[model samples]
Target: MRGIAIRIHREFQLMDCASALSIEGLVLEMVGAATRRRAQGLSVRPSRWIREVKDFLDEHFKEQINLSTLAKCADRHPAYLSQVFRRCYGSTIGDYVRQLRLDYASKKITHSTESIADIATAAGFYDQSHFAHAFKIHTGVTPAEFRAATRKK
Candidate 1:
């Protein structure tokens, strides 16, 4: 009976150790999941960040603005800023910049007497051909054709 009691006590101690280990494992898992969720939450931002990015873009669209520069201005990582900008604005940063340039070019095409090449250059396009291709893609007309049409009326 004495031996049997000692064996039972040892068995209970072992079970207690096993239970403690199981609880510790569960606690660690819960902590890990919480950390992951917090990290994911941090990636999301308020609309103000997007507005800040848009304001910066509006100011610098005529210059060569890239993701890194925009991110720096916004105090965000490039990838994170890109993600938030797209989510809030429904367009990529590059697309937004391109649209701004095209919009500026269109205004120039209609209101100014500058040549298409010079307008393209002023709008931050690398050259006339590149501008024409991009313009056609966006506006469904070449820059000259669009210019002539706008000038007609």
Candidate 2:
């Protein structure tokens, strides 16, 4: 018989009860997680960890964010978090953040005397160019152009 060895990292652990099962049964048992994950359609409602994930995104949109770190907080995988967050919120987290930034920029431009650069900074954009691009995409004009047009009309 051919033999192989597997090594597991101490930091990452999985629980398995397949030791007593026959080879075929062990294989079936190992496939159960995958089968159930697909059968149930990974769309869990946003409860528990998902709510915390949403709150974190709302608070931290101005900073660099990583899916791995956010998912770690929820005790879930990034792909899984992305999937269910989208399923529950009707949009991806990225989209939600972008919308937030644009909405905030719109409100700031409409109500505050802050320069576009300052508004962009406050909205979490790296620079005015990046902010302008996103703002134009969201509002159909460059920030200055938008301000001029709004003021004229």
Q: Pick by TM-score: which candidate is best? A: 1
Q: In model 1, which runs have C-alpha deviations exceeding 4 angstroms?
A: 1-46
Please provide, for model 1 over 15-104, each residue's C-alpha lDDT reduced to its tens digit, 9 standing for 90 to 100: 444645554554665566556645666335557867877997888898988788778878999999998876655467888888888878
Candidate 2, residues 6-76, lDDT tens digits: the string is 11110011223532333444445436644554566644566877888888888888777778988888899
* lDDT of candidate 2 at residue 68, scale 0 to 100: 91
| TM-scores, all models, native as reference | 0.68, 0.65
Residue 146 C-alpha lDDT in model 1 = 71
Candidate 1's TM-score: 0.68
Query: Which residue pairs in candidate 2 collide?
Result: none
Clashing pairs in 1: none
